[model samples]
Target chain A: MSPQRSEQLLLIPLRLAAMSAAVICFLIVALLVLESLPALNNIGWRLLSDANWRPTPAAADGAFRVTPMVVATLVITAGAVLLAAPLGLASALFCRFYASPSVAVVYRRLVELLAGIPGVIYGFWGLVVLVPLLGAWRPPGASLLAASLVLALMILPTVALISESAMRAVPQRYVRAAAALGLSRWGTIRSVILPSARRGILTAVILATGRAIGETLAVVMVVGNIVRFPSGLMEPVRALTGNIALEMGYASGDHRSALFFSGLVLTGLVMVLVLFANRLGHRGAISDA
Target chain B: MLDRVLTQPRAKCRKVTLPDRLAALLVWTVATLVAGMLLWIVLDLLRHGLPHLSIGFLLDAPRDAGRAGGIAPVLVATAMILIVSLAVAVPLGLATALLLSEYIRRGSRFAGFVRHALEVLAGVPSIVFGLFGNALFVRYFGMGYSVAAGGLTLACMVLPLFVRASEEALRSVPDDFRRAADALGLTRAAAIRSVLLPAALPGILVALVLSTGRALAEAAALLFTSGYVLRVPESLGDSGRTLAVHIYELAMNVPGGESQAYATGVVLLGALLLINLLTALLGRRYGAQVQGVRR
Candidate 1:
């Protein structure tokens, strides 16, 4: 074969690679839209806003409101993230300014290992252990509170890694400026460093939120699979993800389409967070450069 | 002014500074707590899960509706899915990364667009991937709920991670190797194939391990596309359940399956820990080698 031809052949794979992302994106959105159309056409916009999600075979009279699952998802996501951010930020701070280099390195590796563990294992552990610990608050032991704690653990790594990077990126000159004054170590971090790194911290927390909402298996195993809106953190609740996993096995027709619709909602919510994360994260990168 | 802000050691200033110190202490405690939590989870999993694991459990197919049987078939299914996903992701991911790092200029519109798409891909949840895989692989292609469908879905899920990591791997390859290759009259393809790729292999291997861990642990996307059929899969056409999905089914449905779930989780955790250790060793060696070459 001619050299030019060979190069062109090589370019085929390269071009395929370049275009694959776009192809995957279009395929996911298009497939979701097409598959989800049945639910939209049958139930209209109320599928999103209505909480009653009883999926009977009768298409006309079936209730497809998923408000409870939606709320549960939001509550779990917000609650878990609230718990994680402080812990993550603190860990990041300790590593950046306080820990010895040797200690920091090992701790960092531990965090990485934690993050790399499968989501299912987290679910498994929660189901076996964390849930039982919660039996005092909720009889069945599978409550939103347990799920949130597990979710918090699941997201701690992301928060720490991102926050650490952001903290590291703070100009050393600013640190010197703070130190040149009478300010102590704590005061500098509080007054000068954190404010400058505010955007990164927010982005980190948002990315964690994205993970919390998108998580399925862990939340599925612990949150009791109840469809009712959570009355408290101790109450059994079902997130949108748990709902789909619970019913996708036996669901047919409109019930199935409603599951697809749930998937779309999840995809939409995650995309928003991911998009913002990319935007903010890239700007942070540019600023660092 | 900076000194004024700092040197104001008056009572009010001291009170404000006290909160800062307290907050610092509070954060330190929280960080320590997080570390303690990690140790606790690992130890707890080992304590509860280690007892249930036996050689028979590793090799026997689940019995009595996943209550008494070992996870042999589940392991086999996981292995099959892993092979399928890695086969699809490794070569394609390398090429995509090559395209981004070598074939395309970084600041160009197309490159930026692809990067953004990758970020989106990375963050899109597994459940959505499940839904998409179900619609496209299981329904559109009429593949049914089988290993083929689940594998394809997972390939899509981890492809972004592979691309991003491989791109970094490729970029980390020193430019001098390419320059030397060009001086020897080697073409771009030959230079990359013979010189740069070898240098990037360790990093790429790290990427491979990480994505492999991802594929091994995925449950939701596979549940719909692969189905919950719990038997040894004879071919790509056969429906099979991965260990993750198996654990989910047993733990949630079977009455006495919690112990079994813990056993499977131990296996899963062990696999992950092994992969992370492998990556860390490679990462350190790779870092040192790169530094040596640069110097």
Candidate 2:
């Protein structure tokens, strides 16, 4: 065969393998949607409004209610982001401007290692450590407080890594220019470098938020998995992913379908967050280009 | 010139004094905080788990919470899952990477789509993968909550990471090697196998180790699919509990569970730290080879 023909032939198999990934993703979406539709049809929009979690009797045409879990997901995620964003950004800034190269590399590796530690470990740690610690302060340790702490730790690596990369990508010329214009080093970072990296940092926050929302094992271990509206930080609450994991095995009929519906909602949230992050990444790349 | 003269000396003075001190303080504070958190976590694990550590605990199956139960089964199961998942993921991931880096150009539409899709896949939650595995592997394939199903599901979860890392490693290999191999009348596949694959092995090893560490710690995806059986896996299809899942079950279901859970966690953490250190050492060794080739 000619060289060009051989190259073309090779490309065929490559395309086929790449296409397999797309097909898998499509299958995931389709399965989630199809399984969820039964519950969606039954619950209608009431699923979002009703905080009550009790599934009605089969004769009553009852559907699985998700409002409480949805609220818990949002509340815990927001609480986590609230805690992680500032600390992550601050750590990124410190790494960019403060640490020596050796120290920075060590710190970066630590962050990466922390990031790579599995969610199950985090859940285990939270259950043993954070929950009891919180219980002393409150009633039970397994509450939003414990969940938020674990979530914050879980998402910290995402935020820190992305923000650090963004900070590094900020042109040194901008900092030099600011210094030349009489701005202090910290002032330059605050006014110039951070603003330049804002888009990337925001993208990281979104990605971290998505992670916080979709987390299961860690949250489930610590969050108490109570299906109720969260009244306080110490109150145990159920989240969508946790609910799905906890009950997916025993769920029958509408309950099972409702669990799938929760997955669908979680997927939608993840897709949106990922889309925003992707757009930000592209914009950053284009601007750099 | 006068402005420059006055400003330069004053700026130098200020840098040596207030701003320098403040910057140093700020940096040290942040660094200390991060270090503190890491140390606290490690110390906590050791503190809680050390009391439960015994030869018997490492040898026997778990019993009642207060009684001495060993984590030998959990440790063995975790190892099996890691090996099985790596076996499944490494080849497919490397092949995908080879296709992307060597066989395709950077700006190809197909490459871009695959790259984006992989990112999306990487971002999908573990729970979603668990649901998929429960539906597809455990239920449809009749794996029945065995190590095989969990390992296969985790292979899917880590495949994106491997592909992206391997592609990166391949991309970092110099084009001169390929050109030289081509000049020697080597086939494309031969060049890749002889030159590129060897060059990228360290990076590929790094990716594999990282994925293995992740698989060892995975619990969410294994929750339903692995079925948390407290027994040694006799085969790939046997139900078993990983260290992570075992910890979860013990902590949640058993009384005085925290002690055993902590002990299992310590073992897992120790394994992870060792893997990370080994990966770093391997990366350094292979990194020198790639650097030497470049020079």
Candidate 3:
């Protein structure tokens, strides 16, 4: 066969394979949307507006309020991001500026290792260890607090890794300029480096947010999985993800469709975050250039 | 470092400010605390789980809803899921990586579209993948809750990660290789096959190892697609349970299942440690090869 022909032949398979990801992504969205349409048509805006969640066989009879779960999901995500952002930034700063090179390398590897540990394991660990610890303070060990704490730990490495890279991407000259101006180490980091890397850091936090929001098993295991508006940190709350995972097996008819609706909401939220993060990341790159 | 160098002459004249010292101390403390927590988790699991984790535990099938037996069936199911996921993901991922790096122009809109799709796919929750798989592979395709369905779900979940890693691997192969191949009048296909792929093999292997670790650890994506059946799966068509799902079930649902759960956790932790070790080894080897090229 001619060389050009062979190359052309290879491209055929390669291009087809390349299309799979896009196709798969489209298919997932399509299926979710299609499956969710029933819930939307039946429940209408009440799905988003109501706070009641009583899944039943009859579509009209069930209250099917996703608001509480969505709120819980956000609450957990917010708490996790709040807890993780500072710690992750601190770890990033330590790795980037404070630690010696060898220490930084090992520290980085360790953090990456943490990241590699599965979400399920984190949840398992939380259920085994953290739940009881929190239960000591509160009546029920499983609460939004436990979920947030485990999720914070689970996502800390992501935030740290991304933030460290963002800081590293700051121009060397910027650091030199800060030094030349007699700015203290902290002053430079706070005033110049942090400001310059703010967009990247925001992107990191946003990505972490997406990860935390999408997280299912970990949140399910740790969060109390009670469907309600949690009044306090110790109160058990069910996240959108927890709602799906815990009930999907038994859920049928309208309940199953409602779960898919929740999935759709969760997917929509995550996609928005992903898009936002990508925008910030790309803008940061362009501005750096 | 530059701060130290620049401030050395005035170090004696100007005292380091309180915030500077405090910030440094804070980061160090946070780093220490984080590391300490990681240590605590490992130690606690080992202490509680190590006693029950034996070859017998690994090889025995569960007798009573996972409270009394070993994870032999779970292990087999895990391996099957891993096999199917890797089988599907590796080739598609590699081809996509090749398409990204070798075939397409760098700034092409289509390439950007593919990458965006991957990024979105990567960010999609594993549970959503479970739903998608349940709907598509299980119900629509009528595979039911089987290992094949679960593995196929995992394949979709891991594809983005594998592609990103492999693309980086392919891109790291020096352009000089292409030039050399061109000088020898090698076809594009031949150059990619014999020159590029070999050079990128180590990185691609590392990617494969990492993806395998991820696939093995996944439970959310598997729960619906791979139904929780404890029996040793006779074929891919049989419903099976994975170690993660087993641990979750034992920890959450089964009464008096804590010991078994701990034991199962130990297996997962052991797998994690092995993966980390493999990654470090391959990384060092890849580093050495890259340095060789640089020199």
Highest TM-score among the candidates is held by which one?
3
Give the per-residue lDDT of model 3 (tens digit) for B27-113.
Answer: 899999999888888888888899998899999988888888799999999999999999999999999999999999979998998
Q: After superposition, how far is residue B272 of candidate 1 from its true place, in Å?
A: 0.6
TM-score for each of the candidates: 0.94, 0.91, 0.96
Give the root-mean-square deviation of each candidate in angstroms: 3.8, 4.0, 2.4
Clashes by residue pair, model 3:
none
DockQ of 2: 0.42
As a TM-score, model 3 comes out at 0.96
Residue B49 error for model 1, in Å?
1.2
- As a whole number from 0 to 100, the lDDT of residue B98 in candidate 3 is 97
Between 1 and 3, whose lDDT is larger? 3
Q: Could you report the DockQ of all the candidates, in the order they appear?
A: 0.50, 0.42, 0.61
Ranking by DockQ: 3, 1, 2
- By lDDT, who's the top model here? 3
Model 3 score (lDDT) = 0.87
Query: What overall lDDT, based on C-alpha atoms, would model 1 receive against the true structure?
Result: 0.83
Candidate 1, residues B1-295: lDDT per residue as tens digits?
2322332334242344676568767866886787788888888878888998999999887889888869898888889888888888788788889988987788988888887777778888898899899889999899999999999899999998888778888899889887899899887889888998999999999889989988988898999999889899999989999988887887888888888888888888888778878988999999999999999
**RMSD (CA, angstroms), candidate 3:** 2.4
